[model samples]
Target: METSERIAQRLRQFGELEATTSPLYRRLAPLAAARPELVALLRERRSGQPPANVLLAALQRRLMARPEAPLRGYFATLGGTRAPDDELATAFDAFWPGELDALAGLVRTRRVATNEVRRAAVLRLAYVAVARRLVERERPPTAHLVEIGASAGLLLAWDRFAYRYGSAGFGDPDAPVTLTTTWRGTVPPDPHAPFTVAERLGVDVEPVDLDDPEAAAWLRALIWPEHVERAAAFDAAGAVVRRLGVTVRAADALTFLPGGLDALPGGLPAVVVHAFTVNQFSDAMRRAFDQALGEAARTRPIYRVGLEWAPGGARLELTTYPGGRTTLLARADPHGAWVEPLEDEPATTSR
Candidate 1:
């Protein structure tokens, strides 16, 4: 296939996601379509990479952070919280070409590094919605959490942020930020119920430190330009992680799972959680992880919770060790803005 066709295909997926999940990207989509030259430029930069948005994300990060940049005026959060849609679109039409040129220079000079926005806390909230049921089933007073692809370990501090879905609520009452998602389908387990995290640790190839300006900027860039609430939530979560001093080891998930499980304190239920991470692993690596987890289950009580995508949507699944029974708990938006609870537990072949 031609490079533009390949890039357009990827952009179409991003466009659909933006239409469903982001207000900002939805508005920018038209501009992206109108300018074939910009698409050609992005295609050239992306080469054969599937994630064409990386170039735009880097450009947005640079533009948003720089006070004097022309695009800075168009951002709602930067100058004002509101702008007319037509005006914004006009501004985009005028500004995108020059910014794309600058982006080309930035890409050539190696000023920005590629990174994905890891908002695992959204998944954490999805987990918490049904956590009481899991806790009741396992009958464990304390839960030890080990995360794969933990990124900046922001979600490790999930308990520090407040959550409210419809009328149900969870997390610290006094927390600075509150994450609200629409509830669909059946009600989730009681969010007010008690739970404890005795230990939490994350494993990733390269862990982010919020203290590093560049690293933090990349993360902020990962957020779509319009989702100011998400950016705010991330800042609040980052503060909590920094204050609490969460540990995120620099290691591969498959290699770390076995040893990490073995080192957990005995008697407490060890819960391993990962979201939108496992699919990136090689088939061999995934098999090794499953094998490792199965072996570790022999030593102690272990439960695996995965928030992953299925053919239908993003589903939450729980796997209990010893006998390896897995149950589907809920389905959610890709960003966890809404969750539809499953009334009946359905067994799945995959996590």
Candidate 2:
């Protein structure tokens, strides 16, 4: 192979390696540190190679290119309260050299994402795309959107901030937090359309409150680092949520979904959306959810979009029905990367 191709391949391989975001590093610090020496011991004791080196490589690569000042500045100023912890950053630097060399070797040689991580990544990205498409066709007359995992319900109001989508940007780029979207193909809907949100109601086992600065910060930190857009989106979303706020309660999607009709009397005239959450259930659970959602959708004109990671990268599928019957509108890659259409114009079914 040519030198350039080889180098590109190596870089791609490196990119695939899972690096820690500030929150994740904190979570895994104890685990990674505890298992530091287990690599050699396991290799000797087990029949296969161990994962210690792989972990180290991820740490090293991230640190080597680490823009300490930018990262810190991002955290301190624009990153919200939850950007990243200094101690965690320090720990990563200290551990990088030895661990990363081994890990980098593994990333280039034995590069493969485990089934679970791959699935998670796919699912997350798929949902991310679907979320952006919420305003497609025409931004709703009222932008009030319904969210499922309203953890803190912080993102319920995402319409108010800046969104940077390469050529198709939304919101204010100069805002404290911005979701950067690198447009791969046609862009999703614009936020400036006729949509005006009246409400944001979220349901989570435990929801984050925008009023609490620490909780908000924690939420930012918890977002995956590689998906930089998630953090920026969250900030704009959080801010919007504060302005629109959210009426979040501890509830399950299956039960509350149907019952929610009462809260949205005259039936909501807005696009209702659910993303990345279908996988939270087993197949049976998913089936039951679809069934329940189908039944509830009968009450109003509901546009349904689904994102499933499955075992592959990710598939952003849109299913919009005017009423009961539904059809897959278009499937796309995360962030409008590529759209796969099974039908033209979103399928609309009415009772």
Best candidate (score: TM-score): 1
Error of 2 at 246 (Å): 2.0
What C-alpha lDDT, on a 0 to 100 scale, does residue 291 get in candidate 2?
67
User: Runs in model 2 with CA error above 4 Å?
Assistant: 1-17, 20-140, 171-177, 186-195, 224-236, 310-313, 321-351
TM-score: model 2 vs. ground truth: 0.55
Candidate 1, run of 10 with poorest lDDT: 109-118
Q: What is the C-alpha RMSD of each candidate to the true structure, in Å?
A: 4.2, 11.2
Candidate 2 residue lDDT tens string, 1-351: 223333333333333453433444334334444443423222322122224333432443343345443333323223323444555555444554444444444344432111111121212232343344444645334434566655655444455444444455554556555544343435443333324456656666555666887456545544444445554556656665677647777778777776674467453443455545666678887777666666666665554545554443234454544444444444445433343433333344432
Q: Count the backbone clashes (under 3 Å) in each candidate.
A: 0, 21
lDDT agreement with native, every candidate: 0.66, 0.46
User: Each model's TM-score?
Assistant: 0.80, 0.55
